[model samples]
Target: MELFEHLSLGFGVAFTPINLLYCLVGCILGTLIGVLPGIGPVATIAMLLPATYALPPVSALIMLAGIYYGAQYGGSTTAILVNLPGESSSVVTCIDGYQMARKGRAGPALAAAGLGSFFAGCVGTLILAAFAPPLTELAFKFGPAEYFALMTLGLIGAVVLASGSLLKAIAMIVMGLLLGLVGTDVNSGVARFSFDIPELTDGIGFVVIAMGVFGYGEIISNLAQPEHEREVFTAGVSGLFPTKQDFKDMTPAVLRGTFLGSALGILPGGGALLAAFAAYALEKKMKMKPGEVRFGQGNIRGVAAPESANNAGSQTSFIPLLTLGIPPNAVMALMVGAMTIHNIQPGPQVMTSNPELFWGLIASMWIGNAMLVILNLPLIGIWIKLLTVPYRYLFPAIVLFCAIGVYSTNNNTWDVWMVGLFGIIGYSFVKLGCEPAPLLLGFILGPMMEENLRRALLLSRGDWSVFVTRPLSAGLLAAAVLMIIIVMLPAVKNKREEAFVEE
Candidate 1:
């Protein structure tokens, strides 16, 4: 009954004319971002953060949230039609989705993605609404020691679950921690790592790093590839809806994906990308029925499962951020920046202190999801035509857009140069088989972890045993240790590698 009343308040806020308009705009822009290869939600949101300065906080957040999940919807369009995944989470969709497209079933594949996503998104949102309040109540129990231990668990979880060499992931986290230390110390006003540059005193801007690493780095890497390699093979769209048989086959897969994605999305370092990958891998392991299409060849279940998982994961990934103030991934880290800009502190207090913002954001997602389904289907023709635009024409415009975004953040040329430098560094990470996503997470969490650690120590009178003496903190630390041990097991290591291997 209370949930219904809260939801009613949320709908009242979300249904306002201005909020609805912004939500629509965000969904459309997010779809556009998702259709374009390499222009991810993180970069787009970072670029637009400055633009939202004038809007109400609730409206700004509603729009930004729309972009994140809306991308999950739009990314599948390119993956199905052109064999190009516009979002990293859509990579698995490219495997069977593109195959389905080539086999002249693009329409069914696309419809499966759209409908599955809508259902999963709705489910994920409900789970979020149900779980967040209780989680927030639990978060109030965390002291500094517990908070530090939790962050330690988060960083280790990121390292252990991240796809690729474990050593490379550790290195990336260490590097990010070092980078985060450059700003002035909060305890002592002394600059720790700033090498006398005045701008370094304030620390490197988050926007610069995000735009450079994700935006410019992706552009530079794409430009390095041969033009012919970048061209897409778009299949024609004919049958716009799935067959009844297709529906039967995909429904179970979609249900499994939604459940799996909702669970994993709450974990640190697990988001849409991991959910999609895991969903497809799970489906592949299921025994095939005698007459069913194979896993990779025009399998409607293949198209449905990963799409549902990614969308579900994207929606539920908001749980930790809203409840605990811990960002689960790089994109959520950008959202942290967005919240700070609006002077809204994310965490348990948000619900009690700002109920409208909390519930409104939740309700807006349902509205936005409905808007995406209505917007994506009829606009398929337009989205497909967009793929026809050449990369040669696209790269320069993207580079310019990134430069302008970086420059506008502080209106400083140094930040622009800093972004360019990070771009080179980001490209180098790609060449070295490093995942930059964990780096962003580490960078965002490093300072918070340091502050918590210091506070814990201060409260404990410098007793090192404080971390282990507190029951909650001790338990969290134990979990982190157990996860590390499990990940190091030979069997688990092999299975992890096999699951992440690209099809």
Candidate 2:
């Protein structure tokens, strides 16, 4: 009954004219950018952070949330129509989706993706609403020590789940933590790693680092690729609706994907990318019925399951951030920056302190999902036309916009120089085969981890055993240790490597 009342308040807030308009804008922009290969929500949202400064927090968040999940819907379109994946989470879709397109089944492939994503997105949002309150209740029981332990678990989860060399991932995290140490110290009121620079008194801007590394850095990398690599499908799309047999085949796969994606998305470091891969793998392992398509050759189930899983995962990944104030992935890390920009400390208190913002954000997700379905299906023509824009024209525009966005944040040239520096550093990370996502997670969590660690030590009068003495803290630390151990096992390590390989 109480949940219903809260939902009523949420709907009332979301239904306002301004909020509805922003939601629509977000959905449209999300699909637009998502249709173009190589650009993603991370870069898009990072570039838009400064623009959100003037928006009401609820409206801003509603828009950003729409972009995040709406990308899941848009990404599948490109994955099916062309060989390129518009979003990282849609990489798996390229395998079967492109195949379906080649066989002149592009329309049904897209319909499956659209319908599956809608169902999964709605389910994921429902789970978020039902579970967030309980998680908040559990969060209030945590002390400083427990918070520290939880962050430790989060960082470790990032390291374990990150693709590529484990050693490289750890090094990237360490680099991020070191970078986070720059600027004035909060405790002693002294500059630590500022190098005596005047601007160092204030910590580096989150928008600067995010835009530099993800926005500009990605553009640089994309430009480095040869122009001959891109291949767009030129076949005209027809037969917009799926057949009755198509519905029967993909329905169960969608259900399984929704279940798997919702569960995995709540875990630290687990998000849409992992969920889509895991869902496709799960579907591959299932025995096929006679007369059904094979695993990779124009399989509608392949399109449906991964599309469903990714959207669901994108929606549910908000659980940890909204409840415990811990970002589970790099995109959520940017969301932390967004929350901080509005002076809202994300945690359990947010529910009690700002019910309108909390519930409104939740309700806007359902509205966004509905909007994505309507936008993605009929507007397919526009998205396909966007794919024709050449990279030579697009890259320069992206670079210019990124520079402008970075400069607008602080109205300072030093920050612009810093963004360029990080862009180079980000490019270096990629060249060295390091995943930048873990670096982002580490940077976002480092300051909070330091604050909690110091507070715990201060409370315990410098006793080192206080973390283990608290049962919840001890359990969390133990879980982190166990995850490390499991990830290090020979069998698991091999499997992890195989899982990340796209083909």
Candidate 3:
């Protein structure tokens, strides 16, 4: 009953003319960027962040949140049509999605991805509504030691879950931590690692790093590919709805993905990405018949499962940010920045102190999800048409937008230069087969972890055992250790090799 009352109020706020307009604009822009390969929500949002300075808090957040999820939806379009994932979360979808497109089943594959995302997104939202209060209650119990321990568990989980060499993942995380430490030391009022640059004192801007590493980096990597190697989808797409069999297969996958994503999304770092990978792994482990669509060959289940998981994971990611004031990913960190810019302290108190922003955001997610489904379905033809544009022409436009977006953030040319530099780094990571998402997770969490660790040490008088002393924190650490061991085992290594060979 209370939920109903709160939600009704939220609807009143979200339906205002200005908020509705922003939501529409954000959804349209997000879908456009999502259709383009390499460009993602991070870059788009970072570019738009400055524009939101004039918006009411609710309207701004509603638009940004819309872009985030709308991008998730748009990402699947490219993954299905062009074998390109617009974002990391869409990578799994590319395996089966592209295959389905090649086989002239693109429509159904796309339908499955869209429908599954919608289902999982709604379910995830419900879970958020139901469980967020309890989680908020739990967050209130956390002390500095517990937060430090929890962050430790999160970092370890990110490293373990990340693809490629564990050593590389750890190195990336350490690098991120160091980068995060480049600003002034809060406790001591002493400057560290700034190289005496004025901008360094305020710390590297999140907008700059995100734009450079994700936006420009992706552009540089894509450009490095030979023109001939860039594939464009030209096949005629007809059907817009999945067959009954697809529905039957996808229902269970959607439910499973929702549960998995909802659980994983609450974890500290890379939860949404991890949820997608884990959902795919779980589907494979279930072992459908040999005649069933092959896992990597554009199976509808493949598209459905990961799509659902990523959306569910994306939605539940809000749990950590809203309830605990801890961001689970770089995008969430940006949301924290958005909240701070509005002078809102993100914590349990937000619900009571700013019910309009809190419940309004939650309610807007439902509205945004509905908008995405309506906007995406009939527009499939338009998105498919996007695939016909020549890479040369399309990429230049993307680069232009990225440049303009980054420069607009702080009106600083240095940030734009940094973005270009990161583009090279991003391209290098692509060539080296390193996953950039985990690196991003590490970068975002690094500072928070450091702050909590220092606070814990100060309170505990430098006793390292404080982490282990807390039961919940100790359990999370144990689970992370177990996860690492399991992933590194000989059998798991062999299975992973087999999967890669199949790919």
TM-score of each: 0.98, 0.97, 0.92
lDDT of 2 by residue, 1-503 (tens): 88989999999999999999999988887777777776678877887777788999999999888877666677788889877777778889999999998888988999899999999999999999999999999999999999999999998888887777899989878877877888788799898888788887787888788878877777777778777777776656788788999999999999999999998888787577789989999999999999988877989999999999988888899999999999998889989998998999999999999999999999999999898888888877677778878888977887788788888888888998988888888787767888788888888899889999999999999998999999999999999999999998999999989888877
Residue-level error in angstroms, candidate 2, position 433: 2.8
In candidate 1, what are the lDDT values of residues 1-503, reduced to their tens digit?
A: 88999999999999999999999988988888778876667767766776677789999999998887677677788788877777778888988998988877877888899989999999999999999999999999999999999999989988976778999999988888888888899998998788998999988788888888877887777678777765465555788888899998999999999988898888888577889998998898888888998877778888899999988988898999999999988889988988988999888899999999999999999999999989988888788888888888977887777787777777899998998999999899878879888888888899999999999999999998999999999999999999999999999999989888877
lDDT to native, each model = 0.86, 0.87, 0.81
Candidate 1: stretches off by over 4 Å:
none
Clashing pairs in 3: 96-298, 217-423
1 versus 3: better TM-score goes to: 1
The clash numbers for all candidates, in the given order, read: 0, 0, 2
| lDDT tens digits by residue: candidate 3, 340-372 | 777888778888788888888888888888899
**Reference-based TM-score, model 1:** 0.98
Q: Please give the ranking of all candidate structures by lDDT, highest first, separated by commas.
A: 2, 1, 3
Please give the range of 10 consecutive residues that has the lowest summed lDDT in model 3.
494-503
Q: In lDDT terms, how accurate is model 1? A: 0.86
